[model samples]
Target chain A: MTTGVRRRMGVEERRQQLIGVALELFSRRSPDEVSIDEIASAAGISRPLVYHYFPGKLSLYEAALQRASDDLAARFVEPKEGPLGARLLRVMGRYFDFVDEHGPGFSALMRGGPAVGSSTTNALVDSVRQAAYVQILAHLDVTDPPARLDLVVRSWISLAESTALIWLDGRRIPREELQAQLVHDFAALAAVSAAYDEEMSALLRRILADEPADGPFADLVGQLIELAS
Target chain B: MTTGVRRRMGVEERRQQLIGVALELFSRRSPDEVSIDEIASAAGISRPLVYHYFPGKLSLYEAALQRASDDLAARFVEPKEGPLGARLLRVMGRYFDFVDEHGPGFSALMRGGPAVGSSTTNALVDSVRQAAYVQILAHLDVTDPPARLDLVVRSWISLAESTALIWLDGRRIPREELQAQLVHDFAALAAVSAAYDEEMSALLRRILADEPADGPFADLVGQLIELAS
Candidate 1:
């Protein structure tokens, strides 16, 4: 059988091409299912060339994971326009988009298996989470959040990630509903945190002030009061 | 050194004993680090005896995971006490206790590694989640819930499990605080669902009636309204 014509690309270009191919395969299947030979063949290169870029399958998998991490982190970057609630909704929309676009890779990246559950992969995942935390704080306009606010934000992030994972896995809920539920959960968590922390409480009041009176935010508040009374 | 005296227990007893020993080991270390030799040694039995009960390490790991699942499911059972919120808190306390006691085994069972990520283990985990869902519905006194209520309850269960896993991994927040946070998230998710579904809205009203005027539930409702207005 004749092999496909290979392009003479520069080192960085060739490396990126190999990683891009690997990412697609890894997204579809676990790391163990994807072989160096398949990746090399997919790139129309020799196995030695693949090895030259990544010493082994695990290394190649990590590189792909890193690329995915970068892509996901970039997706969290929304314009700091409008109210915090509106900005969060936009950010969550992009997050949902990323999860939709990179379904398998997002699962593999967020929910690591034995093949990719090493400390290296854990660090990569943590970096993505940290990036998310930084972006959320930036949206909150908090450069140095207190410990309670920090914990609440981190916990909400975990909740969001888990919610997204289940939503993707189940395929039952609509993406918009899930996104709205998440944004509501974020506000609820922030309000809950505010009950105990002055800083979060103050920040929440400010955000709520920016929310429209008849929007979902106002509806959430109305429901809360209805339940209380 | 002389081998210690080994008790010749019945087959089922021996199998249970081996699983108990394996559970202890897996609770302390990952499955890869625990070997048949270590399990046999821990049980003061021969490697062949360990294999006799479990065909291999994977089977043994599955058994340990099953045991963990059983224990976790059992922990979700709370008495039909005064109020749904209080019953949930009691159930959550027991759940947190189980997680705290199981530690690494809890992590392994909840976050399945490739070693134990088989369909068998997945079924076992699903059973535990289903149990939690049933218990929650029972607490709500819902004989037949709508799809939206089912989805919300199931999602909250996932959120609770994910929150527990993160709390265990991070070890930043106190167990009580995390447990309270999860219970709060459960209520918030329910309330958010209520905003869309009439059945859930009615159920939320019933749960709110049981909550004390000056309790955390009331405080949560108060804070939410305060932030909104």
Candidate 2:
């Protein structure tokens, strides 16, 4: 590692580097358990320099959290023209892969849920979740009141958060087995949120446009309303 | 408040008093934050007397936790015999009432989930959670394989735990409002658990026998499945 290369980095790069290092440490231990002094030492900068970017430890912690959320959001919000279902599956796949590689970071987030208010964390999680819902809503050609859309989106957020926690816990299920279940679950959840047969059928067309027409998930969600009825 | 009255108490009564006092403290603060001396002092007894029934602070914490779980399980397994829908609704009503009274204890249980795997707390939480599941299963007519039954029960547990946290965190959705939404969600989840319509219908029949027939949640499970399909 060259000092010249580190010195020449822009402010944005420095911020990202701090978050990256903080996430590494936070994954291994609670944020409180780690000190700003330690984070600064690990980042190879003076403690005051760390404070220059972040006002304090709490600010830094929230910033690192925001960085993680932004990283996740980038994967979820694709260009508006793709097949919704396939894009959704890709987002979920990316989610699982991210958690798989950052097991500690995932655990830290789950553990942080109660320490922070849902409103605090939801700002990050809700944005990524709503972006996915937008694709479905757009493809379904539906127009609804914003409040109702928000409720539906929050419900989907709850399901995805629950599913994410289950996967992150790394219990008995393998990643493949878990991802397969999520694909089915997310599709069913999406269909329910749309709440229009014509809309669903169109959404299904969009979903199947980019993938094989008859996965188990397609069959399962294909008859979701029937099973629900 | 007479000294004579206090001295006349039996060993069982004294132990119960100690537990009651310990629970009051434990509910307000984490286990580590409270101590044997404080508990004994709060109960108006000597420290050694507190240890006579519970060998140590951990045992006392476990005992208090077990009592809370037992109380919750008892409410869930009410003996009322009627339509499945009515019974289910009654149980849910009781469950929500329990939350209103004991939300802190329930929140503590959830926040303690990650701690269960730690050496200091695992056995108590695992056993109590298992006992709670047994109570839930006894109320259901599950014919799924044991593994599936375990997953179904865990799914319900997850829902209940998450719902309790949402409520405890002061979302303050009216009891009926929350229960109605839950009934819908659980019904859809129940339908998806089993394969055949007959089996699903039968399960719903048994469940509906425990709920009211004409309310918003009465046929919500079937309706949600239909909407999904």
Candidate 3:
């Protein structure tokens, strides 16, 4: 039995192993710089095996990008039991961590680099954004937000992405500081949007009530009052 | 004299004309795809003439990118006579106008495409950002802003660039509405920064005082007060 031992891995398990190897390679370099032979070697398998799992290198890249996007989207979900600010900070922490770990891959996925030329890649990127939007709405306890509020949320998502990209490009600020700034930015945007829309205003009021008194939310409110006065 | 009207153009004028023609072509295609022969033909001049002005295609691209950056930096300068909100609105108007007229060029310049490999091109892009930063500081009348305030301004500039890129990608909102939202977002970011820095708080106070009574600033203040009460 020992002499004949060749563990039979299931098809799905083998496919996943190949994708895992590809993701590791992509996280360090651009898709174009990675090759099927390298991925196969990394997985201790043959190039033909990789091709069996994925038709070509582009298929492997798409699979890896999809997995990365899914992982990123999953990180946005945090427990709802804490103060809104704390919950948001936790979400951002996870986000920054992902960016730190998957720098090249995160940037490639966000940019939709020239290597990715399929509609499926675009859809994958959009799905990541949509997933974030849904989670934010869920955190706000808003199932049916108004169009203006929806726009504000979507804009904040873009801002967060841009901020992360810049932050990663240059570690100008401490990671914790960047997270706090982003959280504060989201609240401020929500407050500003509330100025023009009553629905957003109501949502802000609800969200603010859940914030701890000594948290960033209180500081923002205090600053707003001082500025206005 | 009429027969001698071969129009002896000066070196500077000829250079500017070549750059202008190149900008128009670059606005429609990537730098890698645009050729020196095409640029010369567009300018109604011989290819050697373009080479005489710029050493090569990369040199021409760098010159054109520098010109676009300078043009963009100039658009951010609005007279400091009106309300802060109004002044910002005017600045954004000019910016949107530039983006409108130079759609592909604006996107290409901001992205710093693959063709822009020279350090000079990087410096040109940085100069544009630095000019905007200086103009913003001057508008706030701050000779030396706090580190936090400085970071806020830099981050807002990134936000503005990303927002404009997305706006160009899709006309999701009316141009005027998008401008107003960006201006509002800037103010909101300043307010959020004020929560962490006293200098920013003071600057926010000074800027808010210049906002008109029925403007977005007033509405934001009114909403804050209503929410707090």
Candidate 4:
């Protein structure tokens, strides 16, 4: 299978295009269900030409996974402004957008197992988690988080990751609500920590000072007040 | 290498003993790091005897996992009497007790990957999650949960899972604190859902009415109010 409108392209450009194509195919279905031939055909290139870039299917899968891992890490990056609650909500919006687009791939990244058992894949997953953790700490403007603060941030990061993994199954809940609930989830985890630790209490006070009335943090406070009353 | 003080036992009892021995060894170290010979020596039996019960290492590993899985599900079983907050805190305590006892095996159970790629192992993990979910719903007295309630419960389950996984790495934070924080987490996730859903709001009202002044739920509400003020 070849494209009639094929035009000259650089090797790196062609490699990038192939990775994109493989990710698209993998996202629609399991990576195992997608063959190297299908990838070559999808790329409008010959099978041998596909092998010329990557040795085999597994290599190509890992390469595409690497690309996806980077994109996912990039999703957590946000300009530091506004309420921490709003910033996190926006991050979740983009985070779910990634999960929504790459459903199966995202599952594979989080759940590893024998099907995608390469240490390389597991390492990629770890890197994404580490990146998210670092991004959250950067958001908190803390060079060194205290013991309990460390627990709160790490727990929140893991919560967000697992929340996305579970949401990927049928995606029954509205994405917008999950995105907002996750922001609230972070607040809840930190709030509990603040109650137990003075260091976390101070950090939380600083965080809430910037949070607006309409932000998820304030919304959680309002709901708690109503429940208490 | 022989296990001293061996006593004659029935076939079924011997099989259970081997499974227990295998689990104990697997807990201290990765399963791959363990050997069939070591298992037999620990059981004070011959290497071929382990084979008599299980066909191979993978089978023995799975049997150990099955036993561990049942023990974990049992950890969630609590009598239906007290406030849900106290009940959940007890559950977290028992859950962490299991985690502290079965460190590496618990990691293998959660992380899966190629090291433990068998479908049976993955199913065992799924069944444990289902068991935990069902047990939590029973505690709530809800046979059928609303969509958002489903998300809240499942998200809380996942949060508990990842929190435990992260805690196992060096376990720097105090276990008792993590346990209490997890109960607050469930309340937080549920409170967020209740804010938006009438069914959840009504359910939260029932749960909170039975909660005492000193329970985790009351503590969370008190913390949120403190932050707001």
Candidate 5:
């Protein structure tokens, strides 16, 4: 009789089980295509039980997306011990591995929905990613203020995401080759972007100290510094 | 009247008119919301005549997208003009101008499909963009092999598209501020990306010459080089 009744599971275990089932379903189909009934049937539970876990389809989808994101972040953001380049390569290796393993899930999360629809999830992902970038920035000795950090972080992530997506869309590239290219591509771009900032920041700081009045190039430099920050 | 009918309205002029009308409609409504009839009506033309000019809605959208792309490319890729840094700045400014002036259309294209059900349009935009990137690489004096050239072009385009979208989101800061950040950000990243390519390509060329059994990295790099071409 006890066995026939629902098995009592801790909240974390229950949530994990649901996420596992949800990930399997989402991988097989798109977020919009998979219904609550399918998730319940697959999970060996009643439909209402699935709803008890997640209130609606969007909620379920977001959970599944978060699971995938968490999985990737876990692999990608390890505090590996090495030189900056090697450490970055390690992080990127995990990143490439996750994408290679879960292409569809990654696409759905990164490319799906308007930004406003799931701002929370987006923020969560962005924060995890900012930590990863900061790790690399630390290696590079980039101690820019918060605003500058924001600019560089956002810029690099944008570069990395788009480059990865294009390669994923049957660009017919093998995983190892793509990963290598990504490493080189990202590392090289980071150097250039940092150099540009350093040059502009120096010029702008000089102008700000000496000239309060807006000269011809002062406004331009100020604007450029604003951007770098 | 007979002479006017026979005379060729410059292909460029006709193309401009079609793009202008399509951009107007796409700006106010989501791409799915706008239809051929509306575009024709807005342009003061018969529906059939619009069809004759554009073939279909996708073609019209592609034309509008292309026009925007051309405007942007013209602004950025000024060959025989200036250093890579200056050229890149001009290009970034043009992108900011584009978003400021045609916010919705730029948003739709950058946001990707469901705003416009036209992969063809996306591809057309990509091709024009790839060409522009190639021009920029040339201005930077990159003398890499064709395969390497492809990689440089692709990675650069990725940087531009990603930066533009991030700015358009209008979340982090004002548009004006974001635009300046973009210029500084890419200038740094692009220099790094280009520099890294030099190292990777040299490594790849040597490996290919050795013709040793390909490892995972070799295979992936080979596939990426192939795809880029």
Candidate 6:
């Protein structure tokens, strides 16, 4: 890529380019801290030209958030062919990857704070959660989950999210281990819920049946057996 | 209380009164939607006087958030005298009480969004989670917890927060059930962690020893046993 080439970009292309630039900048620092001047300079364009695509900071911030929301939601999309444990582990991998690159922006959006947290932004963030829920449901092949099942999945989603957010603060825990532990956490949640409801009990059995002995779910079982012994 | 009695209040007293007024208003609606003018009116004071007491909306919102932060953290402080399940249930009752009244503001704060989510406000909110961690540690009576224990507690805190936040959206679940489920979740999380670590196993045993048959934690054990048999 030539640095000095002043190639003309189409309107939509320029908008996409600006959103990408703003996302990169916002990802590095909190949205409140990143200014328009930085965004323009990073894009190698004039500030007013950037505003021509976006009317103001709020608009650009929303645009970036929308982009990030789509990207983050896509992380939860997994092929359902593999064991549930493996599928979930891959999902966690992508999630942490997104968190690794977009910590500040994702954290602020998730926490519902910092600059540009309008209703639209809030909805965008929520859509990500909603999307994750749907994807998890699809993986389970269940259209209507039981109440305990609902609680376990939603709680695990929250756990994964909060785990990633806190992990970003200092990353004290090893990433790979946290990822595995999160999968175990999900299995544990479902297993505990299994004891509460018949539907949940059946669902938990069905899930554990397909998992390999070496999978994260089996690791959880092995750990539990250690306690029993 | 007499009707329309305008009593002259002292400086600190007046500030506290204003904070209380702002808290009620913020509790009912998102802080961004609740204007300073509304707060002033709610306090039965002139807008100028309100501004005189607190320079601006952000300052006033911070004051309200600070007060809320203290209230929230206090809810986590159990007597450490009962079965862990009963103690946690009581704490959840108070927590849900806060959520019932302060859903909008608390949700907005916990999610990290909307107006007045400055670094200071974020810190204040974080302090509440930190305090809850300390209080739970005191309940468990552990000076230094294992790494897995740390993960479980912090993850549970995040779980409770997200659970309450999501429940507030439409409250589809019965409040009493959700509250009880939350205590079960804590036990589930700890029980899972116990299988992973010896320290956690011993701790789980100790926590379960004092709990009654009908307690939430025992109910979880009973449910799980039903799955086994």
The best candidate in terms of DockQ = 4
List-wise, what DockQ does each model earn?
A: 0.32, 0.10, 0.26, 0.58, 0.10, 0.44
Worst 10 residues of 2 chain B by lDDT: B113-122
Question: What TM value does chain A in model 1 reach?
Answer: 0.90
Residue-by-residue lDDT tens digits, candidate 2, B107-138: 66555433233433445545555665665566
Tell me the lDDT of model 3 at A120. 72
On lDDT, the stronger of 1 and 4 is: 4
Model 3, C-alpha of B44: deviation from truth (Å)? 14
Q: Write the per-residue lDDT of candidate 1 for residues A101-219, one digit (tens) a residue.
A: 76776675665454544667777877998999999988878898776677767777877887777777767778888788778878877777676667778878887888887666766
After TM-score superposition, the amount by which residue A195's alpha carbon in candidate 2 deviates from its true location, in angstroms, is 11
Q: How does model 4 score by TM-score?
A: 0.92
Q: Give the residue spans of candidate 2 off by over 4 A.
A: A1-87, A99-222, B1-5, B8-12, B28-42, B46-59, B78-85, B112-120, B135-140, B143-150, B192-218, B221-229
What DockQ number belongs to candidate 1? 0.32
Fraction of native contacts (fnat) of each candidate: 0.40, 0.07, 0.42, 0.67, 0.17, 0.47
- The regions of model 5 sitting more than 4 angstroms off are A1-13, A113-117, A141-153, A193-229, B1-96, B100-152, B164-229
If both were scored by TM-score, which would come out higher, candidate 3 or candidate 4?
4
Best by TM-score: 4
Per-residue lDDT of candidate 6, residues A1-229 (tens digit): 7888788999999999999999999898888788999999999999999889999988899999899889889878888797999999998888888999998887776664555357778678678889999999999999997666677788889898888887887777678878877888887778765665678888888888898878888777765554443
Docking class of 5: incorrect
Determine the iRMS, in angstroms, of model 3: 4.5
Candidate that beats the other on lDDT, 5 or 6, i.e. the better one: 6
DockQ of 3: 0.26
> lDDT of model 6 at residue A180?
77
lDDT comparing candidate 3 with the true structure:
0.80
Q: After superposition, how far is residue A214 of candidate 1 from its true place, in Å?
A: 6.2
Residue-level lDDT tens digits of model 6 in B1-229: 7879777899899999999999998888877788888998989889999988999988888998899889888878878687888998999999999899898888777665555357788788779989989988999989898777888898899998878887887786678877887888888788776765677889888888888988888787766554543
Ranking by DockQ: 4, 6, 1, 3, 5, 2
Displacement of the residue B197 alpha carbon in candidate 2, Å: 12
Chain B TM, every candidate: 0.92, 0.74, 0.89, 0.93, 0.64, 0.93
Q: Rate the local accuracy (lDDT) of all candidates.
A: 0.78, 0.60, 0.80, 0.84, 0.57, 0.82
Candidate 3 residue-wise lDDT, B61-164, digit = tens: 88888888888898888888878788888898998998888887677655445653345765776688789899999988889776667777777887778677
What tier of docking accuracy does candidate 3 attain?
acceptable
**For residues B22-135, could you state the per-residue lDDT of candidate 5 as single tens digits?**
887776656667888888788777798787788888778777777766776667656565334345556666767776677666666655555332455646666667677667
